[model samples]
Target: MSLNPLRLASKALIALFCLSVLTGSVRPTQLEVVRMQGEITMVTRNSPTTFYEDRSGPTGYELELAQAFADHLGVQLRVVVADSLSDIFRLIDTQPGVFAAASLTRTPQRERLVRFAEPYQQISEYVIYRRGGLKPATPADLLQGRLMVTAASSHSERLHDWQASNVPELSWSESPELEVADLLQMVAQGSLDFTLVDSNEYRMLQAYYPTLDIAFNAADQRDIAWAFGWSRDDSLHQAANDFFAHIKPQPLLANLAERYYGHLDKLDYVGARRFLRQADQKLDTYRPHFVDAAGEHGFDWRLLAAMGYQESHWNPRARSFTGVRGLMMLTLNTAKELGVKNRLDPVQSIHGGSLYLSRLRDRLSDVPEPDRTWLALAAYNVGFGHLTDARKITAQMGGNPDLWLDVKEALPLLSQKRYYRHTRHGYARGQEPVDYVQNIRRYYDVLVWNDEQTQPLKGEELLASSAITVVPPLL
Candidate 1:
């Protein structure tokens, strides 16, 4: 077949144009995909599972995992915190171009919208009830009355599905302002009959609210995974899969899990509330002592105040069952070591406490900054030997020894001979220090915020003139 030259040339050009379009759409190779050149944006929630600010800085299970993943890829990790799960999904759905990973759960509905990596962790939903409430043994029992669940949560979805099929009469109310913790609180206080929560969250909360009972576990378990935008970019997907494959074997990942989920105790709300109220009153009187101590020790006064409130509610006459006494609760040995004649003297107590805490911090100089501070606080409550024992246990259990979260898990094990038998500090009250440090951190934050709200600015003329260097005696 013979064709004219012009027609042949036109057909050839068309074929070439089609080929160029195909080539342009082709995905880049893993090696050629700008290796270690771009920032890896990881989207996560502010919940404990994802990211949150602690005394040290930003931390959480997902936060650490994402950071480690970024390091493995040789890219700087930029975390994007979302206020809610819906917001996270919206961001991933709309701005597919921005994020590299979304630390979220893998569900059938979400799978249709985004690609998910291999499962990282397994989680289940549960019904939390007050200690004396009727326990719901099954779905049938839950249908007997009104129930509460977080808005737009997997709990709601599961309940909705169950109602539609198994229990036609089942109905539930939703709380928009409440988190799982709040729901658990309501249940614990007997305000609500029941509420649903994630099983992992329930475990963590159980440590604080030990009396709260789990009515039942959800019928199915949810697998949590990292999500990516729906695209044919198999290279990126393949890279993610490869990265996750390495994560499980790494001691750091296990450590991250233990840090956030392990070493939790059920909190006595009645006792905690009473303690908090008394601490509030005492904070006003001890404010000056904290300021002086902060100056003497080169630490944040608010932090010292927080520590005191946590230790003894800032009560100068406070005494613990373990023989820790005074405003900052100095033990006899610690007071003697700090050259304090009397632990009951508020000024001496504060100064001694600051000195002891500073020494603990200084002793851990090799540890990273924020972690060093956390370990010091833990040691201040427990003892250095016990803290070291916990760290060793954390390392042995495939956790990061340098991380406070991991060490916190190990702290509790110090009370258990199964793990602590080999430690230099044999049989210590590991749980006390964990609770002590956490409560102190929470109280310290509250006091700092409250002080900021009431006190005048540092440089204000009246404030400066009225601010006596020495705290006046309480009237």
Candidate 2:
């Protein structure tokens, strides 16, 4: 009954082959494998809106949104940083094997190659100029020619469109290496006569450089959205649409808009003049407080001085109708919370304010860094509950909860019930914090510059102080 050796060997090989086929049948297909794992690969650019570093850590609008999306999908997010817009496109087109979304501009040209998610925000283009420079009223005025912009930007696209349609003879060189902030800096320094920027960016920059003016608006608006690779995965596309559909613009966004842009139009000439003169005289007296408080809280002393200026104009006896009193303007509750018995005591007031700010910052540990700082500033002015509501509104509006820009936009919405009741903090006057932060930032910058200008020339040798150290006013 036994078979020959060769025949038996052939039978064994066939059985082994059959067993292999049985095992292979249970393995998953590529699509099923990816779906089961649920990991999303997102591509983003390194910029203030997309991603950047601050005193805290990684932050930006796109970064927060990407993280949110990953959380929604119940997976880990892998962000691939692209060096340029062109690089982002190339990565999406060629590495279709990996990336799920590219937070990019929703342009006709881009739409032709990739599918775009619903528009999350709209960006208006504008021309930036120095306060006393020749302001261009129209595209034709630009033909007189002193304008520059970053290369490969939406601003460049708008400028090109302007040239092709209205000002055919206008010409300018592109500074490819310059970011929008750098371009604004060039305009501020009068190195460049004009530059183009998204209106939101223009507002933020203007808060810092009040002397910079918007010469004119561009002819068109750019809708910004997430770009997805051309795929048959209609489910992912539909999910994105659903998320955006539920997202509504809230008052917080409005407050942020006002915080950054509103006061720019109202220059506060008298208050500014008073602040300038007083700051020059008293900055030294409070210098030690800044040094001490900044050391304990890990903040710039100049920033502390700036905050004091914004809060109480550095007046030891400053008092607000709202019951905020002292040089740092601590409310009765805030002063009590920080263990300060006298709100008017300069040392206690500064220490209490710094402690309060530090606590606000710690409350937002879930938020990313620069944003954490920005949100803390908002909380410092408006209170923590209001800030939390703004973050919620930011999320509800399809914006990043961890981004200052997004939260800023959401803050003002607290005044409206249609949006505020859904928040934990109920209702608040969100605009105050936006204005408070912007003013402090402006005052701080001027103070820093003033300090640097006077440091060496007065023959006063200042030591290289640690993160904290206050100096007496020389003048």
Winning model by lDDT: 1
Local distance difference test scores for all models: 0.71, 0.69
RMSD of each: 12.5, 11.7
User: What tens-digit string does per-residue lDDT give for candidate 1 at 1-475?
Assistant: 7889999999999997898798875645532453635666778765556677754588777778878877887877788876666666677666543342433557676788777878888888788776767788887687554467755566777777777677766776665445666566566655567778777766555644545777778757888788776765555566678988887666676666655654444235565456557755666687787889898887888888878767676778899788989988998988988999999988889889999999999999899865787799999988888888888888889887888877877888888878777988799989888788776655554454345445432322322233122211112
* Candidate 2 C-alpha error for residue 313, in Å: 1.7
Q: How accurate is candidate 1 locally (lDDT)?
A: 0.71
Looking at model 2, how many pairs of residues clash? Answer: 14
Best by TM-score: 1
Off by over 4 Å in 2: 1-38, 97-103, 231-239, 246-288, 294-306, 317-325, 330-345, 355-475
Question: How well does candidate 2 score on lDDT at residue 44?
Answer: 74
Q: What is the TM-score of candidate 1?
A: 0.69
lDDT of 2 by residue, 1-475 (tens): 8779999899999997898798775544333444677866777766545666544566656666667666765677777887666677777666543443433556666678777778766777788778878788887787654677765566666666666776666677564445566667666666667878887566544544556777878746778788766766545666667665644444433433343344344335455566677776988899899889999998888888888888887898998898889998998988988999999999999999999999989888887655677788888889888887888778878988887767777888898998887777788888888777767766764565456543232101111111211211112
Stretch of 10 with least lDDT, candidate 2: 457-466
Model 2, 178: alpha-carbon shift in Å?
1.5
